[model samples]
Target: MALATSRFLPVLDCPDPRGLAAFYRDLLGWQVTQDSDDWVELSRDGYLALAFQLAPQFVPRAWPAEGVHSHIDVFVDDLDDAEREALRLGALRVDHPPTPQKFRVYRDPAGHHFCLCTT
Candidate 1:
């Protein structure tokens, strides 16, 4: 018999799981389904949650060098409005004057790179 393995969640490393989780929770419009001092999960009604794990010795990835191991792309109708909201939520702009592709890159409070785009 095959073992049942049907769930997948991307876990990000951060010094403070609580704060990073809060950032993703707000960014994804998801609610926290689970919480702990060292771990957190943000989930939507029918989607797998994005999880965070505490890593006291975590180092920020070197973008455009080591590049991103993984990055999230959030599609939005109003790129400006979305970029504004991301900035308000502690995301710092990494790439300005987005390309014709209509995507803006940003680094979250914990320094994780993600994109606000129109796709």
Candidate 2:
């Protein structure tokens, strides 16, 4: 009984996809699954995919904004327990969030939104 069983991927719009993809590739040691001037995808087995899309008019959003909205998408067997543990560990739950399926949103200490999903 899960809301979504699809793989989670976070797509980010950037001025330079190749450059940002390179940065994340080196940072995470994830293999570059796809690469191009317009788009780049980096992924590691058992982890979410990181996608960078080139957008000439892309502008960075302020903190707490969704311009780079990304959820690390941690999967677990128990959503309730995981959400509770996340709250206990200092993650602030988002009230009346917007998203499809059964997922919970929370803001990290830095005010970035992420999702806790079960599949």
Worst 10 residues of 2 by lDDT: 60-69
Stretches of candidate 2 exceeding 4 Å from the true structure: 1-6, 64-119
How many steric clashes between backbone atoms does each model show?
A: 0, 0
Best by TM-score: 1
Q: Which segments of model 1 are wrong by more than 4 Å?
A: 1-3, 97-101
- Candidate 1, residue 114: the lDDT equals 89
True-structure lDDT of candidate 1: 0.86
Query: lDDT score, residue 61, model 2?
Result: 45
For all predictions, the C-alpha RMSD in Å is 2.1, 9.1
